[model samples]
Target: MTISKDSPDVSVIEDRRLSCGVRLLVESNPSVKSAAISWWVPTGTMDDPDGDDADGLAVLCAGMLERGAGGLDSREFNDGLDRLGVIRNISVHDTSTRLSASLRNEELPSTLELLADMVLDPLMPEDGLDPVRSLCLQSIQGLVDQPPELASIRLNHLALPAPFNRSAYGSSQALESATIEDVRTAWRTRCLPEGSIIALAGGIDFDVAADILERRLSEWSGGSKEMPESRPRIGGDEHVEQSGSQVHVEMAFDAPPLCSSDELPFLVATRILGGGSSSRLFDHVREQQGLCYDVHAGYLRRRSGSLCTIGAGTTPERVSRTIESIYEEIDRFGSGGITQDEFDNVMVGLKTRLMMHGESMAARAAAIAADFHDRGTPRTLSQVAREIDELSHRAVDDLVRSHFNSKWASGVARVAVGPSTPFQPRS
Candidate 1:
């Protein structure tokens, strides 16, 4: 399919499907010399077939794919990408694994072919499994010493249900027992054409890209698998005793899921609450009260569910005070709502970020792939900005009231890592 780049308002985005059912999304930008491609496979840790025992199998499979493919050894495969002057990376998350590359526009065909080989013809060798498994095990072990990460993991496990709660970096016990066959089975069962999206950005011809991908992926085929059902909101509190002078606290609240009508309002509310240096959490908790060394809130977006997470790090002596101050601010924001100045400031910050991301080919490619996976279509900068502008103060206030009020706080999931102390929800 050819997209006309004649009109300034017309987006250069084009979509097509291959014979094998792999979806291809491309955005043509003639102004840039470089192009980026992202191959998004919709299977993640949640799709781990071995249940809790193979927690990190998806991650392990991603690592193994990089080790060898198309009859080439690990070194040979990497060297081939280097020869093309391509920058490559692989990311494994809760719901998907993305293999990405950025290279000169002229190299798009060669790079796509190489990526196809990596996904369709990976040579998951027996000798490669041990090393990958060792690396994964080490990562899991390392998480124990990192208080913040440990606390977050514990909170997710306690708050979320099976598979969704599983970490991308699998458990130590799971990796230790994982074999090459397990990784291969994961690839065969989950990594299929039906649920995959190949997003391309920067200087490229859509017809050529579509043709190259169609011919290369035509022979690849597999059955589509249904994603796991959405789990209920699990809210509770837990504290773990760890020998340390500094304490870590993570609090999570249920929020709107991806592509929901409340998504924009919730995002605006979260930013006003704890987005940056000028946010309420930073100004009140860290600056005014001096209760925490670091405190911030993030909106985690996912297919099945989403969360509004607030975390703080403080000395053991001030841990309880820090927790109280966080809740206090949340209550204050929810009750009084945000001022127009605060809302406008957050909008400016969000717009600046969006503009910056628009300038990079790699960022655009990744964003398009994620949008396609999450919303079934790619969103343009104008569309997103328009949506942000559509959110009024009253709408944002309602969102804050519904999702961050004291009533909501009563059911929050809390995780604290440090010398055990009494930390409970305030009435």
Candidate 2:
């Protein structure tokens, strides 16, 4: 493995590339005593060979990763983590299955080694497969009781393109059809070094952390499976009929990708539309009119593209009007553009948020991993805050003018999960 630093001035951030192709990034903050690891493997729900037929196979594979690894059985594997005082999570996402672990500064070496073992040499025990499969199924089934979450998932399914549109919850059919061998093969083939990222943040030395990973993952190798670029394939208004007292609604429209010039301005505009209690959506839809139990809108994205999302939960009778109100408010915000007052308020809140977020070692760790994947370089909070601080209200308002106008409805998709929702689409 070869290592490099950003520059003498920004020596805190470091980067390393393993000969096998895995990339490692670390941001050292010496004041704190805890370190975090945000590891992203290239395999995820979208990479499942079984597709929807055996959709949850990747997730199942992730669960099996926990059952045992690196010569340790399930029990012993977990015991090792406890001994090192590690707080960890491993789960499947759209483009990458992520593993996050946080431990004391001193525990960094052992914890990272154990985690490396988990990924590089997971036992994937036969006895553990059945239980893991059941848990995956239970999560899918549990979605029935989580209407808002289900609404968002369904919306993503409808608004995005195929293969890439799949949710992390593998369908029951896929889970049942998948065998142990299938799960093992999926991990083996997809768990390659290419496109993988290991990011660490907090009180640690980047050189030392990089050295530990370099040695631990020296043998890991493979090329990244090329990610095909996909265009928007927006679906029409859809609803899921489930017995419930309230309706969960979600609306989505494509936004600029992280790489686009329009990305920053669009991000600012969406926050004004619905970023906090003071946002237009909450202030108008929930506080002023009392239309729903809760309402908010925000931005979300994958590796290449992004979406501007609006979500709400409301009573059955009020569902139609709530949806209509949301649409009108979005249109109004776009048409009228934002005021100087709104722009100033948003900037202050956003800047404050950026500042507060910088305090969390775990958040920083995960963010850099995603950044390396999406932007090809890690960005410091100071860098991000400076960019935001430099933005003029006119720039964001101009984007609002061109992007957030009636055009938002042209490609918009809405989803509702409840006993009853208005079948007819709203303009």
lDDT of 2 by residue, 113-226 (tens): 899999899999888889998998899899988998899888888887766778888888989888899999989998999999999999988778878888899899877688
Each model's TM-score, in the order given? Answer: 0.94, 0.94
Query: What residue pairs clash in candidate 2, if any at all?
Result: 54-174
Worst 10 residues of 2 by lDDT: 1-10
Q: Model 2 lDDT vs. the true structure?
A: 0.83
The residue-level lDDT of candidate 1 at 230 comes to 56
For 330-374, candidate 1 gives per-residue lDDT tens digits of 899888888989888988777777778778899989999989898
Error of 1 at 378 (Å): 1.0
Q: Which stretches of candidate 1 lie over 4 Å from their true place?
A: 1-8, 50-53, 231-234, 425-427
